[model samples]
Target: MNAPMAVESARSVATRFADCRDRRIAYRELGSGEPLILCLRFRGVLDSWDPAFLDSLAKSFRVITFDYSGLGQSTGEPSYRSEALARDAIDLADALGIEKFAIAGWSLGGLAAQVVACLIPDRITHAVLIGAAPPGKVENPSEPIFLERALKPINDLEDETILFFEPASPESRAAAAASRKRIEERSADRSPAVAPEIYLKLLQDRAAEDAFPDIDGYAEFLANAGIPILVITGDHEIVFPAPNWFALNRVWKSLHLLVLPQMGHGPQHEVPEMAAEFIASFVRHRSKSQPA
Candidate 1:
């Protein structure tokens, strides 16, 4: 009898494309549609996207996923400015011949998305933020809790996984274990120019730096930009809590919120169906009413 096939969980497919001046950036593309949704993760590589999450979203829209330079397959060791990352996202859209689309980002990518929207508001139709904070600025969590995460040492996979979730359930634990195994296997095969020290420095800078030029006061930008914005956070999320969403709610015109009961930083990965539904609903509502 033939052996059973291995369950392939990493739905991330690899591709290298020119960002600007023919600079190569590694990315993954799935599904197909108008108003494509681009996903930008925190500090994780393209493969870090949960397969189930991608599979679910792929069923609905053409999703574009990519690794920020210096962290994944992209070739770079130089410290990048947030503006450069934002520019890269715009360049990516240009490369794909997409005029305007929806954008979703988490953590650092969330900060980058804000910059992208501000830089080229004409090119982004809708925006969503999940467990995200302004660069060098965070809300919801008390100062002490924020400091704790900033100081936590992400030396190993186990420690890092815990930060992504809160009160980890059995399913989440199993997913973490499976993902760790895949990361270990993949890391053994290829290495990038990521500087662990640089990553650590970024965490410190994000915590200590009192000002971020591009995204310091995101509420003001959101209120002025006049775009449909959806801010979501897990009720149990430790990174950015529901109050942060509430904080932003005070400043924007067409802002909405979705608070999940038992999700975490990566809601799209931890609770994909819920996230996808919320996103699709947001897009549908906005597209029908607005002409962006």
Candidate 2:
């Protein structure tokens, strides 16, 4: 596989907006190759991605990161449903004149990615899920403390560390600090943080009894779609443990799972270069395996 380019800070990339339906979606593009759309995690804005991770992926492919509707610089009322978010992603891709692309989604974004693969199987060439919550009802819900912290306004870097990393490890905590510094690099024209009300609404929606249903059907849909999928997670992920994704292996015909040791919920941020390498390798392998 080709090596990734020199690391560039994500904050240095120019932000652009695309008109999709009635909403304007904010996004950033880097490097150049087959387009790879990165769906944002819950309450995440375009500026939240780890720069090293973005830069690494950009070396091998066109990387596109965008904010969801009603979040960050985008203008629209945000919806809590994953299906709605998936539609917004498709709309943004359409507006950008991108007919087909690979997708990488983290946390809640992963859920939306799955829905997208099902909705537009032909358009999505590959799928990557990182620290993603599994489809259907969550047998092990997020801890009360974590949920409470996430709903509260982020007062500073400490809050972010608590929300995104494991507190027990100094290494993980250090990684969180570095990630926060990178996120704050773009001081001017930065996208606005997600509003508290929107965050609460999303949490409420996820907590609903029917938040996820018919998981088996969703799994079968992905299996039939036959899209290559890469699932990565930290072994210590508190929000959605790595084992949670193992269940999909039985149903997803083309799935590869990677669990990094001594990491937390934000594995990409914690180990950006490694995560990028895994992603690039997966795409490269897929490309080679395809029939000419």
Candidate 3:
């Protein structure tokens, strides 16, 4: 594993806003720049976001990240469909008074990112999809035996640990373990029943079955727009698996795929500095190509 990068000593800003639908969205804001980048997690609360990762991006752009309505601090009952999740992102952006912005989503958030990009292409200038797929079209971690057990009420913690980190590296394993504890702690306050229902609903809501705005064949969308895209996966990510990215590449050859060695699913938390630098570079280059 690479050494953790030291984060800049900038104070992180936090906020809460009501979406058009009246759902309360909680977010953290830091740094300043054009194309206000929106960071959304795969399947956790905004607090579960890695401060180090946010700090890394804050150096280059105004980063805004928030929790999906059903998860984290966002208020509302969870809905499993990608369209519902996508609406939350759009409404959250509108609520924040943002019209155009770059968006990067990791894991499930990546799925949401794809939906948003297609649904509101004009609003998204650039997109970064990390370890995520457009529902139904890609493999899901829920199929794994380990993942099946891990998704179980409280007992799934150990399995989640095994799937989330690189077992070969103690540091990676340790990080995953720590993250598991934090997620578990966050779950403590909510009824255990809520999480399982959310996960099941998300799994069943398959993005492919739903109508999304920007999807015209994933590869076709990228090629036609020549929009900047960064598709990355950990060399050892067992959850999403590396082969899935090949499917993505087949559609978008220009899609930059970086298979980081000795990494796992939670790259943002495991190596925030590396992720930040990569995303920062993408956001900068794309911002420069367009009229300011």
Judging by TM-score against the true structure, name the best candidate.
2
Best candidate (score: lDDT): 2
- Decide which is better by TM-score, 2 or 3: 2
Candidate 2 stretches with Cα past 4 Å from truth are: 1-9, 209-211, 287-292
Q: What is the C-alpha lDDT profile of model 1 across 15-72, one tens digit per residue? A: 6555645466677677766455454544466766666666666666678876665567
User: What 10-residue stretch in candidate 2 is worst by lDDT?
Assistant: 283-292
lDDT (tens digit, per residue) of candidate 2 on 1-292: 9988755557687899999989899988998898999988878888878888899889888999988988899889887678877888899899989998998898888888888887887788899998887576666666666676767776477776766777778998899999888777778878888888778876676665553554447766776566888889877776776776677676766878888887877889988888998999898887412311
The order by descending lDDT is 2, 3, 1
Which parts of model 1 have CA positions greater than 4 angstroms off? Answer: 1-12, 35-39, 76-81, 134-157, 168-193, 201-208, 211-218, 288-292
> Relative to the true structure, how large is the alpha-carbon lDDT of every model?
0.62, 0.81, 0.64
Q: Residue 288 in model 3: shift from native, Å?
A: 9.0
Clashes of each: 0, 0, 4
Residue 134's C-alpha lDDT in candidate 1? Answer: 47
Which wins on lDDT, candidate 2 or candidate 3?
2
Output the TM-score of candidate 2.
Answer: 0.90
Candidate 3 lDDT, tens digit per residue, 16-44?
45665767876666778854545454446
The per-prediction CA RMSD against the true structure, in angstroms, equals 4.5, 4.0, 6.0
